[model samples]
Target: MTSSPEPTYTWGTTSEINSFIRHLNKSHRILALCGAGLSAPSGIPTFKGSGSYWKNHKAAALSHPETFEANPGLVWSYFAERRRLALCAEPNKAPRALAQVARKRKGFVCLTQNVDGLSQRAGHPKERLFELHGSLMDIKCSNKECDYIDKENFAEPICPALAGDPEQPSSFSFSAKRTFTTQRRDATLSTKPSRTNAHEEYKYKREPNPLEALLESLSPTITPEMRQVVIPESELPHCPKCDSLLRPGVVWFGEALSKPMFDEINAWIEKEKKLDLMLVIGTMAEVYPAARFVHLAKEKGARVAIINLDAEHTGGIGLGKNDWMFGGDVEEVLEVLFEGVLLNG
Candidate 1:
């Protein structure tokens, strides 16, 4: 087979990528698989890249059932904070370009690993785009028994325990002077309690000072009455009949990808009319099953183009043979490609 000519522009430059866009316009079916890097320019940090925020914490601890079993409240809190962060971030230019391409093209599908829902926000047709990792904007009941899946604004009220008890209060109050430190690996932050019970005595020490006096000296920073929210095994949300705690619907580490989701993707790929080209943007191309799609597309004789900051062309997929690998910021590279070739065409 004759190899495609190598385009001669530096990655992320407009000059060379425009040539590539011209190449893409000839194809009818285009499939794009996006990853965290695509959203980096929109202020969303890449999940596993250099300077990624998740580098410090153990990802397993946050997503595994074992960790949630040990402390569901803690896990929920962590995810809630993540939801807040995602809400604040906006979709970048890459998604906008993908959306534009999808609108103009007859057969375009986008499969994304990001949970930020930016692709949809960028005006991509929801029917044509698939979120492989699920979404951060959605919330489901922690009780397996309850079918309480609902759309939530980032600032929803926590379960009562998380909010603390209003009726019965504890003598031991939280100190305002407490400071928190976030883990470097994941988005988890640890707050150190100021007071620890030195004596094994379960009872509060009788220091004869009135509660009012204690309250007066305390800094306004501390909310003494606040109780830590903990999801107990006994109270785990469950199916009404089965009584199971409904857990977060996210795909966790070491867990198999959802079968139905896999089926949908496979069906799309298996259509009699094979794709004309496959565009992989912003991914390291390391993860499973998703990575296999590119290989399958290439096997079926579809041209492949990869755009990423740090990507490797493993599996002997030669770049010269109807394949191009461009490395750099996805947004900038796409801007150049779209403006110079796609839009102009």
Candidate 2:
């Protein structure tokens, strides 16, 4: 069978975006693919490029399956802090706009790489939304034999010990270049160190990576006293059904997405012949499998549009004749698209 001729795409200004959205409202089979940048306006940290760190550790170091296996307590502490923050974050205008449009449009699907439930919080229907990476709010048993999975667990750590506690005088420095203060697990003391502190306090010219420092502290050269900072296994979350440990339900580095989710995405592709509009929002399209979807959508004759901060979107390799690229703050660009449109009327 012959495929349709490729449509011509225009590089658009905010006004042009608004005009496109006006036309989009009358169209069917819209798909929005979202990433961590979608929630950045709500003060959530993204895991792309430099300057994106969580608890002074590179997010990649903390979000690996091997890291979890090596130090479950550390992994638990990290995710617990993430969940605590996510619970307080409200859905921003961008996702809410998508949700409102989905309500008025038919054959709308939202696929998000973010584990945060912001889209759902904004009233996107669960049936139409697929969180490609599993949600942080979901917890599953770590036991290979157990098939236990719990949704919306909202689990928090109970007085989990910190390896950087000041009183213990561990080998690692807690603060970047300031007097280290101890933070209690009960919300006492400040969590973030002052960024403007003078650099003289550091023991070395460059600060050590927190995860590497952690490993060094754990080595046999360290005295027995420093080991006390580690959290005991019992302090972490455990599976209720089998008494095994529980881990975050997110798809970690070096791990495959759940088979059911992979199958579901495949099924979605088959069901929609004309995925006329494909919105790749907030993600850099750097990861595998998920990154391939852009090519797949284009091959299926979908008009691909990318909205991200990365320079690659402006113009680079593999860009087709019918591919729109918008480089800007996702929320701001989306506001331009939805303003006086679905958001207002």
Candidate 3:
């Protein structure tokens, strides 16, 4: 397909962007593919790059199946912290503007790799979005037989061992300091918190002074039960029928992308035939499947615009002369773009 003539705009000036907005408004269908960078202005952390917080840990630790299998309690704690962070963050102007645009237009779809759920909070229609990474607010049992899932506040007492133990209560003491190390149970299968380190390991031993103070600070009000304790995976909730521990339902590294989600996104792209424009904001565009969406849109002859603090040497394959590549802080650039062009147009 032939590319459309590049529209002229004074990038930093409102008039330039208003021209683009006029073009956008004329299109019948538009789709947005967002990444972690889109949420960074709202204070969510990016997964990879120089300033990322996950530098010490592998990406899989937060979303990998093996990590969950080895220590469901530890995994849940990680997500609980993320949930807390996300809840405190407010969606910035970009998502809000996109939502406004989406509401006014027909056939708009947003596919986001972020689990923060900010898009929904920003008033984007639920049916128009596909949260490909899964949501941090969702919890489910690891036991396949149980099929138990619930929408509980992540800040609530979350421990695998405490699942069925009414006598056992939830506490936040372990949420930040909790750590898990792998130990082989046997040749075939392994259990987390293996007998080797199950509460008796030298490292697991609480220091006499600080540990006591920590325990004291954990007021019983933090949990429903009066007792303040951190349950190891050994004490996590077990499947009532099969006696298996429950775990959070996050998509981790090395795991296949959720089949149902992939299918849904693919179906949307197929039905659209061609996207009018693609706004790639604040992402490095390195990851698979999610990054592949940009290629698909370009293949179908969509105009692509990239906005990021970092630069891509290739300018993304298939981006034409008409497409714009604006490099710098996304929020600042977007403020300029929207105020200059979109809002006025």
Off by over 4 Å in 1: 1-9, 12-19, 49-56, 141-148, 151-244, 311-320, 340-345
Ranking by lDDT: 2, 1, 3
Separately for all candidates shown, the number of backbone clashes (residues 3 or more apart, or on different chains) is 19, 0, 12
Each candidate: RMSD: 17.3, 12.4, 17.1
Worst 10 residues of 2 by lDDT: 177-186
lDDT: which is higher, 2 or 3?
2
With a 3 Å backbone cut-off (N, CA, C), the pairs that clash in candidate 2 are: none
Name the regions of candidate 3 deviating beyond 4 angstroms.
1-19, 50-56, 151-231, 234-243, 313-318, 336-345
- List model 3 lDDT by residue over 6-116, tens digit each: 432212223435556566656667767777657866766553422222313333333556556555555555566566667778998877776766676657788887888
lDDT of each: 0.58, 0.62, 0.57
Report the CA-based lDDT of candidate 3 relative to the real structure.
0.57
lDDT tens digits, residue span 80-154, model 1: 545555666677788998998888775788989887878988999887888887777655665544666544334
**Residue 52 Cα positional deviation in candidate 3, in Å, after optimal superposition:** 4.3
